[model samples]
Target: MAPGTILLVDDEENILQSLSRALKLEGYKVETSQNGSDALNLLKNQPIELMMIDVKMPQMNGLEVLSQAIKMHPDLPVIMMSGHGTIETAVKATRLGAYDFVEKPLTTEKLLLTIDNALRFKKLQDENKDLKDQIRERFHMIGKSKCMLELYDKILKIAPTSGRVFIFGENGTGKELVARAIHNNSTRKNRLFCKINCAAVPKELIESELFGHEKGSFTGASKTRKGKFEIADQGTLFLDEIGDMHLEMQAKLLRVLQEGEFERVGSSETTRIDVRIIVATNKNIRQEIEKGNFREDLYYRLNVIPFIVPSLRDHADDVPLLVEHFLKIVTSENGKQPMVASDKAIEILKQYQWPGNIRELKNIIERIVILFDSPNIDENHIIQVLPLDGHIKKTRFEGKKPLRDILRDVEKEVILLQLQRNNWHISQTAKDLALERSHLYKKMKQYNIDRGNNSY
Candidate 1:
């Protein structure tokens, strides 16, 4: 490993030479500066891990230098040294964010110990800032709709705790996105965030996938394998499409939730873990329990805190923002100059029923960016590229309709498209349309759309 870089600042040439030699001998990279300004300039040009500065210096005092250094690199640790050291000066240095102070006559052992502790603290702060940046990039949850604002508020409030989050939404409605937001905002953000698609795994393999498998446990089990639970210890584990999990697996899952312990496949030994569980399902788990497809106990265990992700159609006001964001991403990826969609094109997009929610919208924008060469893409360009299906038919009113009536028609069409995409699950349909279950039911009644209870 590379040695940690230390910037030593002192006006006394003899002291600088002596300390530089001793730190170098102790396996640290050292740089010397006679004055505060030169040290600040060096810090700007190069990455300085730590700074050791004499308290009394010409031109700029050591405390002023320390304050400026912190402004530039808050995580950088600075150790103040003084021959005329006093308790008041040490207290002042500490208040100014100095890591620690040393007497002028420094012993090699004492100096090395202080440097080690300061470097360790700086490393921890850097790691924490990097993790925060990663979370912001990955789980953006971009939107400004009223419903989106509410969801954001809920996530901020619940993320600090270890509460189990149950996300309810339709396929492609960004359920996984919400789960990630919670994980990234939680206290265990630095730890692993493991995910498993319960619906994607085969019924027989789910146990092995969640609780690891011993050697010779199954057909392909040549070696012992760690499972999602073990990998996510001290972090968060996201279980996607949980409502589709097999009834038998649900029983095992309930047991694990009740007691944070599970035995690996084909092994008698039990392992315990500390993991926060977050589950997402595009199905109505309550209805599944009623239909004997899900366990009541498991449902309750996972539903400690419920979060519903609204689909693109439900938040029509955000369509313009999403369109711009997609345009930026697609244009950058294609290495082309950015393009803008015309107002007419945006209006057409807002009116259309997004069957596949935000995912479909993203794909459509990418296709348009690649195929069309126009600077200003209009409604005609959109119509040409969009898939030809029952959802995109043009309509003309025989007579002038009220604005409210027109909007209601648009809402009805969008809801219908999402219902078809989600196979008519009311809970999933509501999430896709950004509506509450109660609100969707009222709208269904108003629109005279007859969906039987057996749709799920």
Candidate 2:
């Protein structure tokens, strides 16, 4: 079978016939045209993956034809041929969008190789485009509420700048989504958009993770490595859970922001990078500063463009739209029949306070799709999947309690909520909270929280 179709365009009949026969023998379906005008007609009318055209054609020459063909199909690869080949003519063909220029009498080996390379290059380009399309679709924001509209406006305004962005939002409220949207719209969209969870990395290794270390820099440094900052050069770097960074690391980060450079761990050589920083944290930055948990100078430096992503509970009206969107995505991914929710079921979802925000809501929709056999979901399905303690508990700010104590109370409530959602399964709850099982157990012990004592 022919690998792909190729169009052969030349004013000379013998050259066209010879090249057509050669390409046919090489497993390409070949079409021959004796003039530039006929070649352009064939290009417009046929599924030609590649075109080999002569520069010294009669009426409309190869360069002229190349320009029109490019306009017609910008991705089609064109090769120019001429027995009277000159650097001037070759350069003109190239500027006019010829993929390559070859002198005739063309070598079959070289011409075939060029055609094969062009086809492979086009295939790679198409695949890259398809992958990017899928990413854009997956990260797309779905909402038209007043808050969402305002967010969209802010993203558009900030996307064109090179400012440091500090996003304030709870976990699972899509802070990462906001960062990606900004990067995709920015001038550096073609470059990398690297990310690191500041809290996820161990404190001992966070510096190495950001600045990269030389070979044999430390105990387990097996090979030289480039860090997030180096990898994100000429691109955007998203730092999640910025408030959780230790004070010493914060000072190092401040130095990088101030000087646009850093020395990798155990190395004296400094590496400079041009990276746009975007940081996010669910913690209150001002409170962290007051408590001496975060650096004041670093906060000011990173807070150039602050965005407060509204919590899902604050925008309950968008619940119906969110539910429908998640339902379609989940059903399609799971190869299940399309599912819709009853009006009453949607109302119940809207009324419930989503402690875990949009992330929790998405999980419930997925659970319903996977566990239930019904094509249409009703209130019972929603109720069964929702956490038992669906209501948000009001945290009482006692005047006599210290600020730290009050913060602890809120943290305990959050842990308890996640535990109930996971049915007191420590491992699952720990995973949900982005904590190691041992750390979660320590928190449970610190709060004296026990499943037997507290009823969901």
For candidate 1, what is the lDDT?
A: 0.86
lDDT of 2 by residue, 1-456 (tens): 238999998888899888988988878899999887888888888898998888877788888888899999988889998999999999988888888899889788988888888888889888998999888887888788899999999999999999999999988899999999999999999899999999999999999999999899999999989999999999999999999999999999999999999988878998899999999999999999999999999999999999999998778889888998899889999999999999878876876778789999999999999999899997667656877566444434636878898789777867876776566789998998899999999999999898765432
Clashes of 1: 1
The local distance difference test score of each candidate is 0.86, 0.88
Report the CA-based lDDT of candidate 2 relative to the real structure.
0.88
Look at candidate 2 and tell me the lDDT of residue 455: 30
lDDT tens per residue, model 1, 26-53: 8998999999999999999998899999
Clash number for every model?
A: 1, 0
